[model samples]
Target: MPQNDRHKEREIPIEFDFYNTLESLPVDNRCTIIMISCGSTTVKINEHIQTVTAPAVLCISQYDNFQCLERTHLSAKVFHFDPWYIKACLNFENLDDSVPIDKQYVYDRNMLYMFTKHHGYFQGIFNLTPQQYIRLNELMLMIGAETYAQSDDYWTCRIRRMLRQALNCIYDIYVDQCKLNFYELSENSNPVTICTDYIHANYRNNISLNFLCELVHLNRTTLNQRFKQQLNCTCIEYLLHYRLKISQELLSNTNLKIDDIANQCGFKYGSYFNRQFTKYLGISPSEFRKNPTGYSVKESRGKP
Candidate 1:
């Protein structure tokens, strides 16, 4: 396979392969792994074992011990990429390296944070619906084809775009599954659930840690700890992020003035809102509103 080196850095740290090509389980390094089952198989990541039937997906993070315990009539497609590749593709920073507990699928943490204010982690396995399975399979096939395409001026760019699309599909499925699982697991009392609901419902008004503590009947210290434990973020962080989300929606979907948007999204001052928006998204509200699609890293870097 040919590799592309740009500015002395690898343009894309990615590999595509088939399950039957494996002679042994490869040691995990800096790469993230995506495997789709073509038939029933049992695999172990760290100490957790999962059975994946045909059309199922499994995502393995860097440094996790993985083993295929049982395979019968197994054929699969696999994709591997490093964190830098993901960061370049998604235009985000400080991405989490921790492997989610759920083995059924993997998703981008930042995308999930933007929507849910939670690290994209979940317990239990997910089985894709028939439609989802078909869609993901088709995406993986496209990625596999691009991975081996003849090298050209746009080869790397094409692969990156396909990979990003595949990641987005997985993320959409993850979000839907997480929503259903959250309700099922919490029965409506999960700390993360309660806090997220409250933030979404009350982001237009000021929210404080003490107020959340009072509402949830937990002390300030306990509330912070549990919130972090469940969501991988502090309650206050979640509140700020949720408010920013609302602001972004307004910026994209409404002609509301910046000051009004800030106030409606719980920011006391528009200047503070602008600062936070720039800090988080690397783009000002005005810039994003003018060309929302240009906010992506690809655009910032002058790539397609």
Candidate 2:
């Protein structure tokens, strides 16, 4: 079989729901796509208010703290996905790399991955046209149906197809409607946003303090100072914690081996990963993986 045609079987991290009202965000704090099929509502996301109307689409991520401030006759289809899902679906089951250069054109609107970076960043909400509403609604129905049924091994691929279509439709309208600030990004970019965004996107990569300093155009001390002033931690500290955060997620949410988890989270060695995890969280990786808790490394500082 051709390499392009060969697909590895695995789980896809996406969810679908029908909501009479979006009283709350997606369960487990996953990223979500809210398709407002009817009525209208206004929501406050991270203190920024935006109104979403019928035949409209809104996307939010785990970081988006949103509340429904007002609503009228709101009914919707909700699609929630893991950050890894966008990568998984697009790459046809390969989870490691972002789109390879050769395979970039394989998926339309590969921007779906970019759209999910930060909650409400890159313009996640859109008002759909009547025709778009009809088409997207049909795709949603197909997605919802397939998600519940899981009729075959190819189920996820089918759902991914519909999802890509839906996101593409949203992107078409979103591009024309929202004046995205890509052109003037340099002016708007900040040290914190730049560094944090890079960490989030490339946590899996082999990253270093020097590389980060060069990437953000800052020296070690100045970068650490900026991070401390705003975030209360140095850049390297933030990267370590971010990797641990992801490792914690994989420990609890996935069945991957501890060694694999370590590698995936960018730890050079399994022993080093275990030592850091134990030192910070007060438990070995294997111990935590076996009997995991919602342990916050900074909050509870793990069990005694």
Candidate 3:
């Protein structure tokens, strides 16, 4: 393939799924697409390769099973997760990578390998050796186990958010290591990582640009400029979205009244909450809860 052909090309968004067939095997290089109907699955990849140990998302247009004996010598584990879950975790639509893929691209988004000709920071963290890949796969499964064990939509969302963060880490590694092409990013800075961590830590509080600037060690203008350039949103806009997302979880999981959920999500009045919720989420809290299995919180005897 020409260097251009090897370049990262975006594709149309397609319906993709994940599956595990380690119990069965494919005759080498037989392309197959694993379909995940729901939930996440993890597999070990033991084939060793000389690559750095970090998380990277992979894109698969097809799937194939590798033939391997059921022996301890095998060297790779492939972790499979619902494509929706992956998409839910990444705001791919708004990502500002130089080689931007179309939102409609249906390529497999795996955390395995990247095309060599593709150059960007996203390539850094996710591409890994078989051993390192196996370890990361195990960690993802543990997270999934904790998520399902809780059996609460609240925890599920939390886990989903965590998965998104993990994927973002892969992308961050890509951004962190790759040469700057379009964005005027700092030479040795991962501002998104810093800003997001701060946001999550103080999400429950009434956080603002001035406060976040102090926390992330950047001035308000620089912070605002960089976040908007990279994430496609201002700091405050992202916070509102984050708070609204939390409120949606609260409304669905708990029997808490609208006002209560609003207060808990940092809003002081039910009316303002209702307006914002309706504006962003496209439904009132009451309307959302009316869905067949909206969100029901079963009080856990203990936290997972």
Candidate 4:
């Protein structure tokens, strides 16, 4: 692979190789690393370890440590990017404020939050379906090509767009898998896990505390106490936050009407939704959609 000295720091760096590349890349906390296996292999990311076959994806946050525990018939492609690089390439402002930052590892804190809240079903390993694997592979190839080409005309914009699309693709796969696992674990998992999974799987529905209690076979008082004990928030509060988060994403990414977005996010009244959005974000949904970078949860709510 060819390297570009001019973009040695500015551009998002990607490595597409089988074995040698892994040995040369240091375990630095300056960037978030994603490793995609091209064949079946076993790997360790921090204390969590898993064995996945080809076309699987694993993400190592900037705060976590990683090592390749074992390798048999394994080939992989790895990509890493500094938080600032991801912010500049994707045009996300105040990304550091939205995500927790450390000297050791880089991460989009918002994205990691969503993954932990919604897609914790998979633990650490993200096993991709064959179709998703192919799409991600192609996207990685495009990113690699753009990095090597370093065209002065439009390559920078092209690379950013491709990188954003790849990230969105990975997110969609996680969401789909979470839904699948939700149904499969409906009968097997513990009450708290099941309740949380239910929220993730059906946040778009009009779910009330009673609905959650019935779904998880617990009474109102027990459910509330246990849920607060485990997640530090009542069931209803969690649902409200979940809806607000989804509404924020729709506002940032789409041109949908506020009312429509509210409806899609399970809010029965747009006015109520607007009030909650303003309360949590300290800005109207309209303002947030226009300039998402201006507001920071850390500054407003003092929380990630």
Estimate, for each residue in 117-202, the C-alpha lDDT of model 1 and write its tens digit: 32223322345778877877787777777677635566666776777776677667667766777624643456556566666655
What global local distance difference test value does model 1 have? 0.61
What's the candidate order when arranged by decreasing TM-score? Answer: 2, 1, 4, 3
Which residue pairs in candidate 4 collide?
Answer: 29-104, 62-105, 62-106, 99-109
State how far residue 100 of model 4 sits from its true place (Å). 10
Q: What TM-score do all the candidates reach, one by one?
A: 0.47, 0.47, 0.35, 0.46
Ranking by lDDT: 2, 1, 4, 3
Task: Return the lDDT, model 4, position 235.
Answer: 75
The clash count of every prediction, one per candidate, is 0, 0, 39, 4
RMSD of each: 21.2, 17.6, 20.7, 19.7
Quote the lDDT for 103 in model 4: 32
Given candidate 4, what's the lDDT at residue 204? 63
Candidate 2 wrong stretches, greater than 4 Å? 1-11, 26-29, 89-110, 117-123, 178-304
Q: Count steric clashes of candidate 4.
A: 4
CA displacement after TM-score superposition, residue 86 of candidate 2 (Å): 3.5
lDDT of 3 at 125: 18
Candidate no. 2 TM-score: 0.47
